[model samples]
Target: MLIKWISAAALAGALLASPATAVDLTVWAQTDLSPSASLGPVAEAFTDLYARFQRENPDITLKYEILPGGTEALPNLLTAASVGNLPDVAILDSFWVARLAETGHLQPLNDLWPAAERADVLPAAIDTMTFDGKIYAAMFSNAWRGVFYRTDQAKSLGIDAPPASWDEFLAFADKAKAAGMKPIMIPGADTEVTTLHLISTFWGFGGDLVDATGKPIFFEGANRTALEKTYALYRDLVQRGLLGTEVSTMDEKALRPFFYTGEAAAIANTSSGLQQMYSDAPTLKGNIGVFALPLPDGGRAAPILGGQTWGIFADDDAHKQAAWKLVSFMLQPANLTAIDAAKGYLPVNQAVWAQPFYAGDPLMQQFKGIFDGAKIVKTRPPVPIYPTISSALSQQVAGILNGTLTPTVAVDQARDIVMAEYTRQSAR
Candidate 1:
């Protein structure tokens, strides 16, 4: 036994010392990690960081694969998992973490990650990467959503401040419309953004899309009532002309042109828009002001901490250690600050938030204030059927906006569409 242990130790030392024996691990993501002129500064920073990592750890080299977002990413990951050919790490969309972790193939990283290092992230942000009470991934970047209004537009329209309460929001809209300005626009062109802009409205009324066990329960009991009320608000907004029918056709990309052209007084968007606002309409950047969506009876909006997370899938011990090393390095305060600040992504790492970038940027400070005021932050549920649930709700939401379905019928139909998949996920 002593002789065998010594031999194994010697082999390990030799491999560690040899450059040819370096671990070459794979990392897959929907986002571009390589430096590209078309991509933002964050990607460029990440590209530099990757090169730095390779230099620092001469024993590891990462193989990168950029996959198609939404349409093919999950399917590719699933196929890879089924064939036992999964990468050492993958960038998981917030919604994909729950589904991918359900495969029982993703290794729970809690044992490898130190609790002290984990504490640097927001507790709610960390919750997004958790499934079945195990931490499956590490979340570093985030896109915090809120309502962005033209500050000068609001001032000229005689609005003293952004709406603070639901009643105030309604009054503010009335004033803006009276002044020949379109009130607020919430984009509904896709499954994700459609629900994202208004889901917090449902949350404010004390409703969560799922229960503690990760079952779809938004259609049950008071949750049903809250959702109905939430949907009714949208239907009523359209009926009253406060929110436009064109919203159903508008995506986040469309929102910039609408707002910049002096068409819409306000729009709901993510923190990343801070950079886009400057790039798309530098003249309007200073005019823009951000506020959380006003919920009924003064309930503060709980910012949904949604973003890409890194999950390790490697089964071998050497690859696991190497993958985690790369992930942890990328998530370090300085590295995260470099990328997140440059790109205007809200930082999930508290240490990154403390950096001068966030402190100096007024737009980011507003987002941070909105993020800090909330009590119960929301993340996509830890269930595989979340995309199904989101899709159903999004479709019904569009129908509700178009007057093709009542709020009750919309909720009922959405429930019918996703229940089976929800049940299957629950069973797993």
Candidate 2:
């Protein structure tokens, strides 16, 4: 047995607790919010939240085990869910919810996480967590992704100001080059990050990533033009010798150190990247800022929202109740604020916006406005095949940046690759 169920009433002196007999829940997670995982204020914030949870529920003992994410995690999850051999709780990525929920192993969270509680967060949280009318998970946080730049380094980079549109951005490149820094670095290798970071640009130019049937349409008429314009941005920089060949190998993580050291003028990143910079490169602290990735003339912003959610796998009522208690406590506005603020996640709970962190953080203040004015906000499509699509698009982007393929050829190849996957899935 992975868990040793102990009732809250039994742990306490009470003969009968309101929950009757809530068991201690076990958690399986791949999260990075552990105190040991970060330094400075981030560690302090996470440590305080965990300590507060312990103080609030002195009798409830919680246990956690690390789990892998991505390809390796899926089969293990499927097998466990099938046999009813699962932990009381799991921190499942939003990306995996569709496939896991389809297996009928995840318990619907509505019974424990009431509608009142659901209403406490952004609509996207509920929208993404629900699959076919069932809410299978409670979202803890999401990434508000955009362009990150160093306010302190702006003078050194020769950038007069943060660019608000593509014309300004193209003009800013010259200023950055004169200062011997890369104008902007985009990830081409980490396909999902690459896709998410650039999809806004593609969508802004009137591109449709997928058709109504969930089939990819990157090479189709208007989308083709939109994609060409998107990739051309990267191609133009390469042609100008502003971006080195190393950019083709870079992902979001690889883009950071350059920014941290003031070697790059700007880069694409999520909210968490701000805290990470504070932790990893303390000197960049107050100098960091973010802006929406600007679009071309007549184009609008398309922001992608991605999240992580808590999934209950405990079958017995006792363990399930305990899991909810643990999950709910972690999600409490004050506690979650510590986690979200320190870890750099955008808050899922609407109440957290009123917290001091949002008010004090300059980057968050700027991002909130960008989020408000965003023309399109959506999660990656909920279909199970979306990952495959994301990966294929990412590959084409790498080719475009590396000069291995023209924008036209890259999209054509991506269309064929993705359509092949749709065919395979259909036949199955």
Candidate 3:
């Protein structure tokens, strides 16, 4: 017979368990909003929140690692996951969330956070994270891509406000050109920026890569029209010397110097750029304005909403629980307030914008207007093979700009590539 020996203190400790016995958690965050001088405040806000979280729960140690920008960090993440060493939490681009979820690498949050609770998030903000009818991540912020224009330039051009339709926009561009000003500053060499700006026009023209049936639909009337319009704009700008020869070499960073110095009348950029301009050129703060990209037919303006999201790694129950707690804490209204105030990103929590900090800001008010009527905003196709689809579009757009391919042919090629990718994804 075996003798059973248990200390009374051991029995009492087991019976009176505390959260201090919880597991440590690790978070991997991409460094998009951290390095910028204007955006540094936002990073500090997140750090403050993390500090408060640690103070509240001393038992659960939290570690956050900042990853490099762009695709350079993806390989490291993949390697870590392959070795069963994934972080407890990570921030992902909304576009990548579906792909990650499909790999079974992320935990679905729907089971833990009820649909009713998630209803608080804007529909557009939540759409990308929902794959196969399951919610996998929580939207952290809402971002919009549109034209940033100089208010005085618009006034001097006899335009009191930014164009409300594609026709009006073109007219304004023509007027600006006749007045000896570069109407728009676009970095043609930066495929990412060019593709993103062109996609906004595709949406404005009511074209999309995927349909309601979840089928690929890129070769069509609106898509062709949008592509033709984009190609024409590119050729006209390049030939007119409105866009510098260095366009092919200019990235978003290089294009910024042109805009801030007022070399170009307008630019297609994200709202975060506006925040930076405010800090770098404070005197020009009230001289700039933001507006949605107008449709060709003078109908509703459409803009693309893009941003990062918080996700949980598929892991043990304890880790999952701790991750959820962190997410919930970070999403609290106060935390979102701090985030928006610091980062210049729109809050996913609607209530956060109603705060005193944002209420008096006119530019913030204009952003709210654009965001409120942003139902037309849509994500690229949610298939796990979106990277391939994005690449094909980028290449086709480049070919169109380089005069190697017509818009019609480029769109046809993009459609074929998307269909093939869809087929490949379906097979898996």
Which candidate ranks first by lDDT, i.e. highest?
1
- lDDT of each candidate versus the true structure: 0.80, 0.76, 0.72
Better of 1 and 2 by lDDT: 1
Whose lDDT is higher: candidate 1's or candidate 3's? 1
Clashing pairs in 1: none
Write down the TM-score of every candidate: 0.89, 0.89, 0.85
lDDT of 1: 0.80
The digit string of per-residue lDDT tens for model 3 on 162-274 reads: 78767787888788778877777765663666667767766666667666776666566666676566656566566655555455555566677767777788776777566
Rank ordering of all candidates by TM-score, starting from the highest: 1, 2, 3
Q: Model 1 Cα displacement at 367 (Å)?
A: 1.4
Clashes of 2: 0
Candidate 1, residues 1-428: lDDT per residue as tens digits? Answer: 99999999999998667587589989887664344424577567868888999889988987888777664788998898899888899778767777788888888988988999999888977776776679998887788777888878888877767788889888888887887778888887755787877677788777879877667898999989888888887888888888888888887778778788878888878776677777778897657788887766578566777876789998889999999999888888898887776677888887888899888777778878887887767876756567788888888878888898998998899899889776666677
Error of 2 at 282 (Å): 1.1
lDDT winner between candidates 2 and 3:
2
* All-Cα superposition RMSD per candidate: 6.4, 5.4, 6.0
Candidate 1 has its poorest 10 consecutive residues by lDDT at 30-39
In candidate 3, how many Å is residue 184 off? 0.7
